[model samples]
Target chain A: MKLTGAEILIRELIALGANKVFGYPGGSVLDIYDMLYKNATKITHYITAHEQGAVHAADGYARYSGKPGVVIATSGPGSTNLVTGIATAFLDSVPLITITGNVPTALIGKDSFQEVNIVGITMPIIKHSYSLRSACDIQRVVREAFYIATSDRPGPVLIDIPKDVQQELADYNQNFEYSMPAKTIKIDLHNAISLLLKSKRPYIYAGGGVLISGATATLLKFAEKISAPVSSSLMGVTAIPYDHDLALGMAGMHGRYAATKALYDCDLLIAIGVRFSDRATGNKDKFLRQCKVLQIDIDRAEINKNILVDEFLIGDVKEILDSILELLPENKNKSWLNHITKLKNSHENLLWTSNNSLTPKSIIESVRSVLGETPVSTDVGQHQMWTAQYYGFTKPRSFLTSGGLGTMGFGFGAAIGACVASNNQRVVLITSDGSFHMNLNELATAVTYNMPLTIILLDNNALGMVRQWQTMFYEKRYSQTALDRKTNYVLLAESFGAVGFKVMNVHELTVALTKTNKITDKPVLIHCLINQDENVFPMIPPNGTINDIIIR
Target chain B: MNSKKHPIFLLVHNHYGVLTRVAGLFANRGYNIENLSVGCTEKPSISRMTIVVDCSESLLDQLLQQLRKLIDVIAAERADPFNSVSRELMLVKITHSPESGGQLLEAINIFRGRVVDMAPESLIVEITGEEDKLNAFIRYVEKFGIIELSRTGLTILDRGQVSLITKSNNN
Candidate 1:
């Protein structure tokens, strides 16, 4: 259909699978807004109080959907306001298609009121960006922005359209021919198979990229065939079924003592679709000095990016894995499996003995029993670590947490997005009290959409992670980590037209979860009043090696 | 003995003011660049950099050991000299004039590059490869105006061969 740039904006959004956008119109984008108003029935645009919230909402949408979430805003402050959200998405590896209204083309670079070079400002933060220089370029830019957002390792892509471009007329009916680069990541199949056959202690450590590239089945098959235990990054929980004997739980900060220790003692490490972040490595010098590392990642940049690998394969996990399975060597390391089981048993026993307080493991177990393989998202903090440690994730797309950026206040909106995207499949958000407050306003959006997510608020009433560090390293000199203020969350939930529960004990938590499962009309918040001094132990302090882990 | 090539992870404070400073340092040093990757670390205030440069093995080691002395650098380490995971990101704008569809498809098939977007007048082909591969593709398509190009430096890992973090004691 031949249409103006403004009409193309609306039409392209529909083609990109955008049913709704979070944004507010302004003078700079008034023409586009007028076109949007006419097509309001086909698209829903929410006018948020702040552009930051709008961008974050879009980010939230992308996190759960694994698609480019769309956001729109006016020029100047409106475009600049989206920077924080764009940067957040950039850091956390989110796919967002953010469209910002720019000053009229002629006014650009003339310091027109509310004019800024948003494309330049955001270039560093986004995967790619575009400024609509002409009306004829709108369709191509929109299509390419989506491509960039969804390609390779997904991230935010911006399209800055000037006001004049929106008003200019153009033919918008164009089919975008899209094909992603398919470079065959070279895998040394013979060597990979041989190393697997030779290892006495072998383990599979999976990460978020496994889910991104749809390699969960291949990973599972490889693990089962080799009888190797599997450890997951925080984002990798869902890659393997938690009940499987080979599943060794999460590895990193707040990871199971057994899992972390197993990583230290393992002979061979098969890292698939994972970028060993600092949190996962603890200290590079002590992370994997003895083990032969086999790294498989689609992005060549990731191979040997941080920690060293003995054999690096630059290919999609699924393809490389299929090759390994085909090049099988007939050798089994029984002793390695036995040792891993022994370590796991001892670790489980230790966790059982250490249940002196309301720990994360207990909470995760409770939630799991109620919501098996349900999608759970978490904000960053001690609570995030706890969720990672305790939650037994079994299905792909089951656990959604930000590991790379560790962006606080990411869970609440993401939970809403997950709920919306997954057809009301109980999206549970495990958030810290501190993080919840940062984007607590998103509760209204959840209520507006009537999303039936169950939010578990770990109320330690402090920045627990920071407090733990201060307590251990700073001689208990409590700095700004203490959150002294209090707001009755039960009352807050009620105010937001959602169910609320305050849990202090296991029984209370179980009861609240049961209640949550029964009621699906609106979201639910269960505030668990946990110990104030709880610390995530076996922590490799920053720059400290695994040996220096504080085992209290 | 030729100094062995090593891996270096340089963590710098995250600031727009310093990216140019770092990139300039590498560009100005006349170092035979191999690979460089920069991304945000777990901490918001710092960025983790993975750089692979082939020099006299001794010089590479000595240079990294000295990188730790910079104030902007939070930490610098020769992550792996022998085994490591590394990759680079690139965006190449290749121009294939309207008359060269046959040549364009041939080039695409050869490099395994994808035609992400195209106008009636030109085509933008996207390819990710070793520096040499990209360079070769660029050479083949030089007839088309190289409108623009951007690249993410490089990122690397040194744990075991397969996983993000190794299960070994070093991890």
Candidate 2:
């Protein structure tokens, strides 16, 4: 049972049920590529156009499939290119195992041609990393990497192996049995349940953790059982269906007015799987000022890290919810529901816009109408917030956006990944001119794979978010926010062997969507010209309280 | 609130780049390590590091959590200043002359220091004690025109038999 390190790695990946890998080949990874070539039928390796694209594909695969995405890259720049995608996955808490091939072990510190300290470079961002010292450690390293990547608030983990180690022989017949120690769940549920039952206005604030832990069902059931309204952080948007009676869309800086108000006015806030990010809790002191907060998270570090809570339950969201459900009493707060309903109604027309030019809202709404329940990914900018405000996601993992890092150029690769992960489901990438321009090279990836993805490019010709801030705070002093570029997106897509459309009005947008729907073989890019002055609404100004939301 | 110095101890695998990972964690988090000393432990495979930081209690807690999360790190805990025995080693080179050599020797003897090396006009004195004691010794030796000084930062262990290493049947 002796095998080369490369073969052992492949076997371990197969053992872990990872059949799909995204990567590009390079000199340092030749031995691994050779092994993969020999065992090509076992694993499907998607050779992406760039290392960044490979990592994003893995990230997208992880997000949609609820499995650890595997990616590979060679040494030096090839490894460095995965930095952004790794950071994106790390910040978003996506499970990813990134394997990079390094220069031979002896040439490590000599600044060999393609050697880089990827471990050092990515140390802060990754959950953990290993630089292989010997070929014999490959199996254990791979197992540990996957275990760490997929468990306990999952994030990206990197394993760097030198070229010589990949070619070295190792015994691979050792028993691979390994299991994480069971975490002891400790919580005074009696007190927590009593507190919930006694509250006149109880609100459940769900975040990405609920989705990561797959606790949406429990969350929905708990909300329904207790008759408590549910508000979601941006990352937790799809935890409850948008049409759910108790669902208060997204709650944050650009959150629904009603949702933010509910958080502010609640008597009790049961926060689950959420770090009170600054964008979510504007002016932390004023956010949930009147509420007694009970925060539950798997990571103990997240508890009381931002806003202090009255009590905390530290464990997996699903487990903790199950425990709470067992001890819960039947209760209803009629007045609170009625008040929330009123707030929802009052802000029903808050999102209305009658502009003649194509808008982000109109574009997102059109996509939603045409592609129901389609997985939507977004590059960060005004378009990201607009999609969060508009897209109606009925399931978890259906919406992918870089919430924690707010990374631009993230959607194209992720959308390509989502499409691949979901068996070529009609995936949509809503991006702005600024964000889309960052990683436009990923267009080649979608076209190469013939991924069924639609690119909704909201071309504002400016960094709309920064421009909006400049207008509001910088005394109308416009700086370098404006791109004012003439590079045609339609031509760009067409050159990449994909159908492209340019729409300036809602009529053209709808017509373009209709045409794009017809061309399903390849990716479609729709360039919508939007107003540069338009801004995301209900924005809480920097360092401002949630109460200081600007409706305009 | 004024920052208080806290000594934190960590047991980590003796491997390349482990120190960088530990130091990088503090640097990335904006936590300043006031003093740090690292060396091999009783077990050659394990290295022990003592990092003294001045920060708020909450920030210290975060540092400990982050340190414990590192893959190479086996254990991380704060060394209770009141319940731990701490020491620092300092080597000071003082300018020696016919008139001041006697005074320097007398000062070194009073502070329980030993002259490890000597030249025509300088003596290298080595002192091991608590941080404050070393500082006091240096202060008394400075009048003789001290030329150079080197210090191995604080290393500490709990005063009791409580061990940081997990006990095994073999151990």
The model with the greatest TM-score is 2
The CA lDDT at A8 in model 2 is 94
True contacts kept of each: 0.00, 0.47
lDDT by residue for model 2 over A1-552, one digit each (tens)? 889999999989888999889999999999988888987899888888789888988998999889999999999999999999999999889999999999999999999998899998998899999999898999988988999998888999999999999999989965777776765655667778878888888899899999999999999889977888998998999899988989888888888888887777888999999999998888876677787989888887787778888888878899989888888877877888899888888854277554756777788889888756689999998899899888888978888889999888888888888888888878999998999888888888888888878999998899999898899999878899989799888899999998899988888888888887787779999999888788889788866776588877
DockQ, computed on Cα atoms, for candidate 1: 0.02
Off by over 4 Å in 1: A46-50, A176-190, A347-349, A352-359, A371-373, B1-171
Report the alpha-carbon TM-score of model 1 versus the true structure.
Answer: 0.75
Q: How far off is residue B133 in model 1, in Å?
A: 33
Looking at chain B only, the TM-scores across the models are 0.67, 0.94
Q: Residue-wise lDDT of candidate 1 within B1-171, one digit each (tens)?
A: 474445577778886445554554455445555766778877799888777767765556446533542335556666654576555556666666657778877987898888888877766777776556777887887775677777776566665654322322122
lDDT of 1 at B21: 47
DockQ-derived CAPRI band for the predicted complex in model 1: incorrect
